[model samples]
Target: MTGISKLLMTLGVIIFVVGFLMQFISLGKLPGDILVKKGNTTFYFPIVTSILISIILSAIFYFIGRFR
Candidate 1:
């Protein structure tokens, strides 16, 4: 297959695996994530989760690039 097609397929598989694992892993509620409650207001942010995903994706792409 073409390079773009292979890359897209690889990403799709990665997303599928992550989504499947999320059923048993609670990354959204990680300790460093932020949750705020003020009277009648509430806010939630998944900073840690975002960072973790970013790191993981960076590493994955780094290796993928190295191999290619």
Candidate 2:
């Protein structure tokens, strides 16, 4: 059981890393509006923002698992 758990964790980490790599190569930004007013920026669709966040979270998980 312990070995199985470790294998599953390793597989999860691999998937997360591959996903993170894919997110970095996306073309163009998310499908949303880029608004700049009063020197402030806001996104409407937020696709790019979401992708970045996902990548960060996945990387964090991957490293945490490896270190553990």
Which numbered prediction scores highest in TM-score against the true structure? 1
Backbone N/Cα/C clashes per model: 0, 0
Tell me the alpha-carbon RMSD of every candidate: 1.6, 8.3
> What lDDT tens digits, residue by residue, belong to model 1 across residues 1-68?
69999899888998898889889987888999999999999999999999998998899889888877
- Give the deviation of candidate 1 from the true structure as CA RMSD: 1.6
lDDT of 1 at 53: 89
Please list all clashing residue pairs in model 1, or write none if there are none.
none
| Candidate 2 per-residue lDDT over residues 13-64, each given as its tens digit | 8778767988877644555635444546654465676787789778877886
lDDT of each: 0.90, 0.70
Runs of candidate 1 with Cα error greater than 4 angstroms are: none
Give residue 23's lDDT in candidate 2 (0 to 100).
85
Q: TM-scores across all candidates?
A: 0.80, 0.38
C-alpha lDDT of candidate 1 relative to the true structure: 0.90
Q: In candidate 2, which residue pairs clash? A: none
